[model samples]
Target: MGEHPRRRADAQRNRDRLVAAASAVIAEAGPEASLEEVARRAGVGSATLHRHFSSRAELLEAVLHDRVRTLCALADELLTAPGAGTALVTWLRAVVAHAATTRGLGPALTGYASDPRFSPHTMIREAARQLLARAHREGSVAPNATVDDVLRLANGISLAVDSLADATECADALITLVTDGLLRRPANG
Candidate 1:
């Protein structure tokens, strides 16, 4: 069933405002940030926020969806970068940078159990699979390390360093740590 034209337009506008507001609030204060503040910032009433999101969990999920779409696009960009190791590291850096930008996103995305048909987790796994496969083929990553392992490691780094003052530094350290752990040592000359 289709809605009246005006009603559909209003709904679309509301969705845009809600998404913008949620992104702002979530970036500022994490997923647990105030819903009312989001509504207020969006220049809409709390009732309207609830009308659009229905609940805090729903808003959080939507914000995550928005972020994942951007992140996956970045992963696509990394696919064309030179060197599998460089591309993998570049992707990891980008992922961590994104995680730092969106407070609580790492945890929210990791915990949300959306259906695979619409699940960002599944998309994320596919992205990881591509990069990890390439890194393995290039002999820069461990042969036994699965996409799931890389994701878990990345998620753990994001969660652990989420609140640090120097999250970028922490993320770099974690990435280097993981990379060193995963790479094989060169034979002595």
Candidate 2:
């Protein structure tokens, strides 16, 4: 016989609560945030958290998955934004800031880039590619600019951001410098 509808609905609710709690906790405490706190915040017991996520890694993947979805959604929305250059710049800043603030996210993303459960790299790459293509068409970005070039550059900057005393400013400054140079010059130039 199939599982009871009420029981299934309850299970889904618990899972949703756990993920929401985990997102907030992870944002505050980084990737190593305590699972116990996640459970408490979600109003679920430890056993329930364990039942939903077999291990810390599993829970981390879920949180990371949500972050990846958010980033991609932003990219998709920016595709139709008023200015292609502005959209590209905004999305790139968001990507860099996300990596900078989310301590351990870079390493986790690298380790799991190929994992379907958390394919941040692949998804972000496609999103960036679309943005870049739009910018190129508008003559704002260099036509030859590839997604690999920008992502690699941004990834390197985020890694460097780890040691800087002021990470957000550093990320923005560095991205601005690079973008200013990478963009196309005006007719007068």
Candidate 3:
């Protein structure tokens, strides 16, 4: 027999809470944040958290998936905004901020990056490509910058200074440097 509708709804609610709580706890306490605390923050018990996520790795994967979905959605929204170059920079900064929260999942995320089921990898790349193309046509970005270049630079900046005491400021500085580099410049005056 199939599960009851109320039971299924409850299960879904629990799962949603766990995922949201995990993201918040991990962001505040890093990847090693306790699952028990996540449950507590979600107003559930540890058993409930485990019922939703079989393991810590599973929870991490869910959080990563959620982040990717959010990033891709933001990219789509930004594409329609005015100023291609400004939109791209805004998207890149958001990516960096997302990366900051997932810093502890570095190796696991790397593994997921190779998996075809992770659509965020493809979606992000396509978004970057379109943004870069628009910026190039508008004469805002340098002619030679590729999607890969921008992704790498942004990812590198996010990872490199994420451990610093003033990580936010450091990230802002690095992003500015990258933006300046990507921007087109005129011939000598």
Most accurate candidate by lDDT: 2
Question: Which is better, 1 or 3, measured by TM-score?
Answer: 3
Tell me how candidate 1 scores on lDDT.
Answer: 0.79
Largest TM-score belongs to which candidate?
3
- Residues 115-141 of candidate 2 have per-residue lDDT tens digits of 555566789999999999999999988
Model 2 poorest ten-residue lDDT run: 105-114
Per-candidate count of clashing residue pairs (backbone under 3 Å): 0, 0, 0
Clashing pairs in 1: none
lDDT of 3 at 148: 93
Clashing pairs in 3: none
Q: How big is the positional error of residue 177 in model 1, measured in Å on the Cα after superposition?
A: 5.9
TM-score of 2: 0.79
Q: Write the per-residue lDDT of candidate 1 for residues 33-140, one digit (tens) a residue.
A: 888888888888988888887667678777778778877887788777778877887787877777876886656656556545677768778887888788888897
* Cα lDDT tens digits for candidate 3, 123-165: 7788788888888888878889899999998889887988876
How much lDDT does candidate 2 score?
0.84
- Whole-model alpha-carbon lDDT for candidate 3: 0.83
